[model samples]
Target: MSDLRQAARAAGTGGNGARRRPAFIITIDVEEDDAWSGSATVATRNAAFLPRFQALCDRYGLPPTYLVDWTMATSPAFQEFGRAVLERGRGEIGMHLHAWTTPPILPLTGADHRHKPFLTDYPEHVMAAKVTTATRVLEDTFQIAPVSHRAGRWMLDETYARILVEHGYLADCSVTPHISWRGTSGAPGGRGPKDYTGFPEKPYFVDPEALHRAGGSPLLEVPMTIAVRRYGAVVERARALLSRSGPARRASGRLWPATTWMRPNGRNRRDMIELARRALHSGRDHVEFMLHSSELMPGGSPYFRTFRSVEALYDDIEALFAFASGPFEGLTLSGYRARFAADAGRPPESAAGPRRTG
Candidate 1:
């Protein structure tokens, strides 16, 4: 343990605590109907996915985190839904602010959010106000202070770091390693590699400048894990082409060849499980997987529709748990983060046994 502490210090972790083994952290970004770029069924599926997902978590004695958008908070049904998650005890509620839907800050007139880009885009001043309001709403509605966050459309900037800190958000999971998003507005840059940059794959503190230099802010930037390989683009393009042929072909889940569909960056259900398995096997158990709430519903993804109905989503949750309990232990973000912090500098425990990475 002492030797492990020295290694962690050399690795720039600062404190001398043992490092925990790889673990699982599942984060569901609770989004609003308005924030979605395409269809509205995403939110409806999210409403379905949550309870069933939570039920699966409960059965396995694992807790999952839900980052709720402020827009979703307005619906009585959704509000009740959020409370229901908290009641489950295996759930953690966090803010999912959509700046556009959120009102502008007080005492700062003319700060309209209409032209601020995404519905979740909030300029600095307005962002502060929105965070405060959203935090209060989550507390009042669900009676729990959110501990983590993810930006709407994965859109965020340096200013958001300060905003999150002020609002008591311990960690932010918006960055996806080696992946960038391009749209009419512009291309979103990535934070790049962690090993070279001295960033930890597991959650750890970063300077606001390093965070911003990485193109964001200084906080515990817990990036979402993405499976990347040389054939990624080829597979994606072929799937897109097949999906475009007709709704029937896409609906059949036969759009992409099975081999191509399971390749890196493929949208198959097994691809997701592979990513989770890789994180667990790396002895860096801090795995955080994310998808827009809409991704869980039918008509959500053009290339892949894993869940055709609410029951399908439940089945996925069950499959995920079956794997986790059998191969690796699971923990919520807060639980994972706290354990990592406490065990900093210590070597990870022994791997239970060798397992396939993908």
Candidate 2:
């Protein structure tokens, strides 16, 4: 184990010196089926899997945080389902911004042509407008103001974080630690944040100007759990080397043993479980798991193109839940934040300056 892992493990004890049980937040990026295509038209998306996804959550007694985007937020059927989830006290609704479809579509001018649906890439004014429109749509449709957000494409930055604070959002789950999407084909034209190479895997309060570093800012950054095992340093070096080229970076992400970002679908179950076990052993209090809602239905996502594939995904999720139930208490994003705040004896709000409108 690396020094950081060793230190984290040693620190994973309660105030009384006993090992603290791990907790987890299962977040779903609830959006349109065409999200990956970058051609997502508002009218072309369907949230057909929401009901089934909610049923799975109900079955496992897990309260998931649905980070909905403009498409899902505006769908009456989706809203009805969300209402039921809220009524049953089974889930929390949060914002997931897909800048392209979020409205007030900024004109493609100058660097705007490089737009990648990542809110952070836009001008501050454009970003603010898009965020405002999306948040308002979600509030108006759901009749509840959301306090948590997840940026589309995992492309959040300091500006986005500050905007989130201004909008009264208290938690963000957009950071994927130890990974940087820059130069990858996934982030077209190589315009994405290049700095997450050394971010802490555990949750921490964000410092707007230096998001990777922990500080006293009120906005809680609950990053998705990504753990690199025995060859962590070696993997980091290789990723850094490959990141210089777009094709190389994309290939590196597909390379196994280079690293693992916990996801429930497909071949990730074993890595997810193994990473969770490591986090538990290291004294980390929580693991944030995420997947796209479209992945829940056949023909919705590439990962689940068939009915059998979809069923297999569910089986994998259930198996992970079974393994984690005893070692980790599952909570929604907001629930985890509240618990973390209470444990730290701090108020739920940010301790930094007043929330400013962007």
**TM-score to native of every candidate shown:** 0.67, 0.84
Q: What is the lDDT of residue 248 in candidate 2?
A: 91
Residue 79 in model 1: shift from native, Å? 2.4
Evaluate all candidate structures by whole-model CA lDDT and list the values in order: 0.54, 0.75
**Model 2, residue 306: C-alpha shift (Å):** 1.6
- Candidate 1 structure quality by residue, lDDT tens digits, 1-358: 3432232223323244433335556787776533335332324434654555566677886677778777667667667777776675667777776655554433222322322244223345666777777777777788666667887656655566666766666667766554444422311222211222223344555455455343322245676665444347876666656666567455533444332111122335576566555554444445565545545555554422554453555565566666655444466666665555445433322101121111
Clashing pairs in 2: 9-282, 12-283, 218-350
Model 2 TM:
0.84
Per-residue CA lDDT of candidate 2, range 1-358, in tens? 3543443445455444665455668899988884565442444244766787777777777789999988788887788888888888998999998776678886443333244546665678988988888888877777877888898887887888888888878789988877877644322433455557788777888888998888776678898888765556877889889989988987976774456777875888888878777776767788877888888867777678898998888888887777666667678888877766666667544433343333
Error of 1 at 47 (Å): 2.8
